[model samples]
Target: MVSSSLFNRASKVFPGGVNSPVRYYTPEPIYFARAKGTKLLDEEGKEYLDFSMGFGAVFTGYANSDILDTQMEIFANPVPEGVVNEKEIILGEMINEAVPSMEMMRFTNSGTEATMHAIRLARAFTGRDIIVKMNGGFHGAHDYVLIGAGSGAATFGTPTSPGIPEEIGKTVLVGEFNHRESLEQIFEKHGNNIAAVIVEPIMGNMGVILPEPCFLEFLRDITEAHGALLIFDEVITGFRFRYGAYQDMIGIRPDLTTMGKIIGGGLPVGVFGGREEIMKNISPQGKVYQSGTFSANPYTMATGIATLEYLKKIDYQSTIRLACWIEDKLKPYEDMGLKVNRAYNMFTPFFNQQRVWDYPSAVASDSLKFMTFFRGLLKHGIYLSPGQFETSFVGPAHSPESVEMAAFKMVYTLENEMNESGNA
Candidate 1:
């Protein structure tokens, strides 16, 4: 009947009363019945202005009509299995046009699979075993990207999840983001053995931390100098920023790029693409093997194509304007010693005053204060990412008025709850 009651039922079968670890917070998680546009309806039929945006997966907003229409059309006319479809070609071409680095492409069911295969491709191509990842960058649930990851891992204070073999951990070398010296040290020690250096051009997992000026250039140069591939794990930042990948906007080109979230138009999909020479190495074509039963399923392909096409027609400047407006409203709270990081339409308000350039800075944020702020905002009909480490997203569906209201709620929460606890 209510979120609490539904959570009680969920706890019986699911761990921590939710399917995903990040979905469950201290007292309880809000169970949503449905979503439309920029609002979510919980089990109690209460509406909240949604800023989580399905963890950056719903950039076009919940239940976008164009994506839905394409989905319906595809389902009406089913295609035979083991046959390539037109939607796949159209979507891939659009993606390649937007991101020129994707000379070749492959589709998968989730971001985890795309990242995993991308790593494998790198190792096979370079004939090396080591993977160098940013300390707080989260690629996915896969073992290779889990070492010192952020997001739910950071939220739970468990950088290294259990059940992952010690051997897997050894292959991954973690370095601080925005700190070139840290990476240089790793390269000096194991440059010859490194297969690739994977990073998120703009970090979403560690709450929207931006890459410092020329930081991405540093990565590109170093990886090239080391004879290793540079992988941009753009799963969260991909279409959320632009129609293309975020790397393009930063003026850096990686050897490989992994994308998910927004491209699916709120469905489940992941794509990896890179230089033709590197992609040629993938199986049926080369030695490294990767395949999925639902790879580029017609349904997802159609929606992805529709989503990109629609995005190309819209003026994203308005969304950015609204985000800036929200940021302006929240600046007073920042003056009181809170750090707010914004990247395009997505942002995060870290409870710490210091700018979060790396994992240590991100971890230094006051988690308890964030919890209080989060709960207070929830009470005011604003939905935020449950985890402090995760980024909050706003889309075209979120109007200026809605954002202003959310910003007002944020300030109120900061003044009443955060200040009461001596956080502000």
Candidate 2:
């Protein structure tokens, strides 16, 4: 009732009563009054166990004290001088050390800007016009990166949103994730003109689909042979699994890396970096120009530094162990026709017979059934990402008791769905 009242009033000014498209859904979206650790309290004082983790952005947990303290200090001295600052320099150094591919780096206010600049940098460096992106691999909102986007775009069944000029979409080619032959065919058709092959190394946008054996290695080999830059968009994966980027874990260095979400330390931020030779093209160095007023705000920089420093101290294997425990609980549902795809601290359970590996297979999942399951889970005090295509994140804040509670809630919800369908 409280959420309904707020949604109705907010809808007058904002479309769908929410700032972000993904937050809106049927009935009404719950408005959280406050959140801490792994728990969120709604407007009506009802508490829910959070598994979304702010769409995998709050890796260090909600309202992390260390980050908040640093953020407060920066707020005391709000200086909007020129872009370059001490905090920015330190954060850049931190990023480069974590991701070796980032020989040099630049910061942006959001993931969309970082991705947009990455594409432009690739084009400038390679002197090519075409950009190849994996099907359902979401980069950002820019015209060049929007083609065949997943996440909310795929959830709404609109891969390429309207208003993006047809000519703009033409320069972007879509390749299948985890399918080597499909990429080979695309290369055969337009390899010469391609500038870069952009991808989410772990494919978080289309749930938690992972690369098959030698799939990443295949990407590295093919892109190198074709003389195209490989851009790993680790916006969701970066800092979520390990203290650094996922590319280092894969052992395949990308030419350029776009990162966001966790690196922001629960603030809004994005960063793109690459080899020094290729990065020199951006303004003040080369012809290609990119600038932003809030590119490296001191607040975001300080918080990010604290977040990464704290993450470095954390034992990532512990979080993964908890994720595995949760997955083990979901394994029983497999016999009842559910498929669970997992990678590190992320997982997605599909209502289909097959394991989802690509965009097409991901879309084949039963959304209606997922929606019912989602609503049921919410009633049981478990909050999940609303869309079936979005991946659920497990954080270090999720205690053993929290994992056990989530497992119980999940099983009970699944049983409810089965009973309602007369399959129990």
Candidate 3:
């Protein structure tokens, strides 16, 4: 009744009773009144083990004292806009040190703006128009990325949304994530006019789909061969598995890269950068123009640096160990003929028996049964994203007790499912 009443009031104001389309479920989205380390207290006073983790933005956990203190200090002496802030340079230096491919960078208010700018830079630098994106890759909500979008768009069955003009939509080409021939076919046809191929190196929006062997390497070589820039949208994967960008570990350096989520330290922020020659195309330096009022403001700069500093000292290996342990426990489910795709600290359990490697196969996973699985987790006080296409994250803050409780709940739920199907 608490969340229901809140939804009733919210629906009158916000569309679908939520600000974000992904936040809305069938009955209503539950409201979390407060959050702490690895937990969310709902409007009804029920506490949930938060597996969603702020859509992968929260790496250091909720209400982190270091980040909060940084924010407070910045608030005490407010940051100025329309002028150069020293903290932006400091943050930029830290990011460049971590991800060496970004020789120069620019900040934006959101990943949408970052990707938009990156695409524009690519087009200007290469003197081309058409861009390529993975079929299920979600760069952001902008018109260039919304075509065949995954996550919320895939969950709602509207891969391509309305309102994007045909002229704009036709320029963006879509190809499968792990499928090689699909991209080869696209490049074979539109090689000359293709400005860039933007991809998520490791797909996050479509439930942690991993890139196949040499898939990323192929993108780099092919884009170079066709005189097109390769952009890696590491918005979700920036620091999910390591201290640096995933591309660093994978040994692939993109021409341009867009980063968000963990880099912002839970603030509204985004950054895009690459080789100096390419990034030079962004305004005041080159023809492509980009400017934002809130981009790299002192507040975000301070907290972002603080978070990255904290992450440097933390052990990411701990998260990998914990995630692998959970995967080991869930491995029995695969023996029982179910699919659970995982990569490091991120994973998703599909409700179908078939494998999911691309957008079409991912879409085929049973959404209704996944919702049932979602409700079962909710009953046991585990909160994951409601959409099947979204990835569930595990952070450094998660405790053994929470994992035990969650594991028990998962096995119990699946046992009930098998019984229902007369396979127990």
lDDT of 3: 0.85
Tell me model 1's lDDT, rounded to 2 decimals: 0.85
Runs in model 1 lying further than 4 Å from the true structure: 149-159, 419-424
TM-score of 2: 0.95
Please list the C-alpha lDDT of all candidates, in the order they appear.
0.85, 0.85, 0.85
lDDT tens digits, residue span 1-424, model 3: 8889999999999988888898888777788899998899998899999889889898789988878898898999887876898999999999999999999999998999999999989998988988888887999999888876323311211237778776676677777788888778788888899999999988888787888899999999999999999999999989778898999998999999999989988898899999999988788988789999889988889989999988888888887777676677777887565577888888888766777777888888877767777877787798887778988888888877787778777888777754432111
- Expressed as tens digits, the lDDT of each residue in 244-334 for candidate 2 is 8888887999999999989888898999999999999998888888998878888888889999999988889988988898789988888
- Provide backbone clash counts, one per model: 0, 0, 0
Q: What is the Å distance of residue 115 in model 2 from its true position?
A: 0.8
TM-score of 3: 0.95
User: What's model 2's lDDT at 167?
Assistant: 75
